[model samples]
Target: MKLRHAMVCSSNQNRSMEAHSLLKRQGFDVSSYGTGAHVKLPGPSLREPNVYEFGTPYKHMYDDLRRKDPELYKRNGILPMLKRNSSVKTAPQRWQENAADGCFDVVFTFEEKVFDMVIEDLNNREHKLMKSVLIINLDVKDNHEEAAIGAKLALDLCQELEAVDCWEDAIDDIVAAFEKQHKRKLLYSISFY
Candidate 1:
C-alpha cells in the first residue's frame, strides 16, 4: 500500500511542525496543522530557520528552539538525519490553508483536545471511506511547562519518524505519558473499518 497524505494536528503547531518535517525525510508524504487557526507565534517568536552551516534539521529546530526558549532545547538535544535538508518548521498560514481542505489519509493529533475534535469531526462527516484517525497524546503545549517536555517531545517525534513506515506505528512507540515513550502497539492496536 502506498501510504501518502498524512496530517499531524496539535493545539499549537510546534511539535506537529517537527513531525511533518521528519516524516517527509522518511519518504512519507505529510502535512500539519493547529486546532486554532493561529497565524503566527504569539510573542518572542523564533526567527525563520536558516540552514546551519552543516545542513541538518536538528540544528535548525534546536537552534530555533534555543533562541526562542533556551532552557527547553537545552534539556533535549536535536538529531538530524544527516542527509535530510532542514525545513523551516511549519508556518502558521501554511497549516491553516492546507487543513481547511481537510484531505488527509491519516490524521494524528498530538494534543488531547485536538485529538477528540478531529475524531468527532471525522465521524460526523459520514464519508467513512478508508481513513483512520488517532489520538497520540504528547505534551505539545509545554513551552510553558519548563519548555523541556515540549522540546523533548519534538526531538523524539523526529526520531520516531526516522524509521517508521506508517503513521499509526510511529505513534505506538510513544508511551501513554505526556513525555516519555515506549514501544507497545506497533500498529497492532489499529485496524481500519
Candidate 2:
C-alpha cells in the first residue's frame, strides 16, 4: 500500500518544501505544511521578515520578493525555493488550519518544535476516524543545504516504510535500523486522527 506522507517545518519554506519536492518526484502521495501562525520569508533584515497569510500563493511571494530585491532574494535562494514551491502546490498551508486535509500515514517534521506543535494539534482534534499516524522528528537546520540532505534522508525512510507489508507491525524494526544506519537520533510518536 502507498502511504500518505506529510513534511512539516516551522515556515513551510525551506525544509518542508525541499522534502515535498523530492517525495513528490519519487511518486509518493505527499503534502507539506508549516506549523506557524503565518508564512514568513527572510527579508532585508532579521527584524523585517516578509510575512504573508497562510493561503497566499507562492507565485505572488516569488514575484514580490523578486521585485523587492531580485539580487538579494536570488542570492539567498528564496526565489528558487518559491519557484519550486509554486510548481508543487498553489500556496503555503498551515497545519493547524488544514485539519480537513485528513490523516497522513506518516508525518515527518524537520524540527522538534514543529513535531511538538503537530502532536498538540492532533491531540486537540476529534478522532472521528480513529486512525493512527506516525509523527517523526529528525532535527534539521533550517537552511538550503540541510533541507536538501534532510529531504534525501526522509525519502529513504519512506522507501523503507513502503517496503513493509504492514507498517504498523514493522515500524519499530525499521526505525531502529534507520537510526543505526544514519547515526541520527529520531523521535517518533503515534497519534490518532
Off by over 4 Å in 2: 5-9
| Per-model TM-score versus the true fold | 0.49, 0.95
lDDT to native, each model: 0.47, 0.87
CA-RMSD of model 1:
9.3
Residue lDDT tens for model 1, 1-193: 2444666666653466556665666666776666664323333335743222212234444456567766543443322321121353423333334554555555556656776666655555555455564434443443434233443444454445444567566554443432334432211123232
| lDDT (tens digit, per residue) of candidate 2 on 1-193 | 4676555555558999899889999988788888888998999999999999999999999999999999999999999999999999999888877755567888999888888988888888888899888888988898999999999999998898889888888888988998899999899999998
Give the worst 10-residue stretch by lDDT in candidate 2.
1-10
Judged by lDDT against the true structure, how good is candidate 2? 0.87
Q: Which ten residues in a row have the lowest lDDT in candidate 1?
A: 184-193
Clashing pairs in 2: none
Evaluate model 1: give its lDDT: 0.47
Best by TM-score: 2
CA lDDT, candidate 1, residue 80: 31
